[model samples]
Target: MLTVYAYQKCSTCRDALKWLRDRGIPHEVKAIRETPPTVAELESVLSGTGGDIRKLFNTSGVDYRELGMKDKLPTMDQAAALELLSSNGNLVKRPFVTGDGKTLVGFKESDWAAALG
Candidate 1:
């Protein structure tokens, strides 16, 4: 089954969920804040994004700013960055989807159509 790591209050996550529902795409919704993705799962998802760790972060999130990740991330090693993200869902991009050999960050209707269709 496909899994969507998302925060319930995020509008983008809502839209992504709707997009899947409208298309009759089955998925399991996981509250990112309550249960963040595991390190292995994050690694799998990262592969789909071409190993660009920056894409895995929620750049606009409060935590990202509060923690000064924008400045710190560039200096952090891959392992440290991955560990930080795995421990905090608030730092991850919303509606992170993983399934069918693909992983997606955030919501883009066209992207979903191409990836899932």
Candidate 2:
């Protein structure tokens, strides 16, 4: 089953949900703020995404900026990055979806369609 980690107030997340429904894809949605993903889960996502952990981060978010990740990302280790992401759900990308051994961050309609197809 597909698991979607999303923030309720995020328009992108809402759009992603709509896209999933439109495509008749079944998914389980979890409120990111209420239930942050674990390190293991993040590891899976990172691996599935070919180790582009930066893509899994909410780079533009206040939490990210406040945490000084913008300047520190290039120097941080994977473990440190994952720790920061796990510390604050808002610092992670929205609409993080994983299933069928595939992990996707953010929502691009074409990308999602291709994945689902």
Candidate 3:
């Protein structure tokens, strides 16, 4: 089963969950704001993103802007970045899905279909 970390108030997250339900995909949902992904999980997603640590972040989130992540991210190392993400769920992108050796962030219908279908 897939594990999806999502913020309940986020429309994107809701859409992703709906998509999963509509497709009959088996998954468990965790509130991203309450329980961020573990470091290991983040690392797995980072690897899937071709080692682009930035891709794992919710760049457009309020926390990102308030914390100035855009300016600070370029200088942070991978471990530091992952630690921050693991500690703060709001900094993670919505609908973070991982399972079955696949990792995905955000919601792109085609991408999800290709990966989960």
Candidate 4:
């Protein structure tokens, strides 16, 4: 099953969920703010994103800035980055979705079509 981790108040997240529903895509939604993805899961997503750890971060998020991840990320290893992401959903990008051996971050309609189609 497709698993979508999203923040309830995020407009992007809401739109992504609506898009899925409109397409009749089978998926399960999780409240990301309450239950962040585990370290193992982040690892899988990183692999799917071509090993780009930065793709997992919510660059515009308050937590990302407050924690000073911008400069810290360059010095941190993938393990450390994943650990940080697992600790706070707000720091991670919204509408993170994975299923059928595919992983995706954010919601781009064309990308979703290619992945799910």
Q: Which stretches of candidate 4 lie over 4 Å from their true place?
A: none
Residue 103, candidate 2: Cα error in Å is: 1.0
Candidates' C-alpha lDDT: 0.90, 0.87, 0.94, 0.91
Cα lDDT of model 2 overall? 0.87
TM-score versus the correct structure, for each prediction? 0.96, 0.92, 0.98, 0.96
Give one digit per residue, the lDDT tens place, for model 1 in 32-114.
99898888888998888888899999999999999999899988998898899899999999889887677888899898889
Candidate 4 residue lDDT tens string, 1-117:
899999999999999999989999899999998999889888888988889999999999999899999999999998889988999999889899877787889999899889987
- The positional error of residue 14 in candidate 1, measured at the CA in angstroms, is 0.3
**Per-residue alpha-carbon lDDT of model 3 for 66-95, expressed as tens digits?**
999999999999999999999999999888
Alpha-carbon RMSD to native, per candidate:
0.9, 1.2, 0.6, 0.8
- The clash tally of candidate 1 reads 0
Q: Write the per-residue lDDT of candidate 2 for residues 1-117, one digit (tens) a residue.
A: 899999999999999998889888899999987887888888988986778889889888988888888789999999988987887899889888877776788998888877887
Rank candidates, TM-score, best first: 3, 4, 1, 2
Say which prediction, candidate 1 or candidate 3, comes out ahead on TM-score: 3
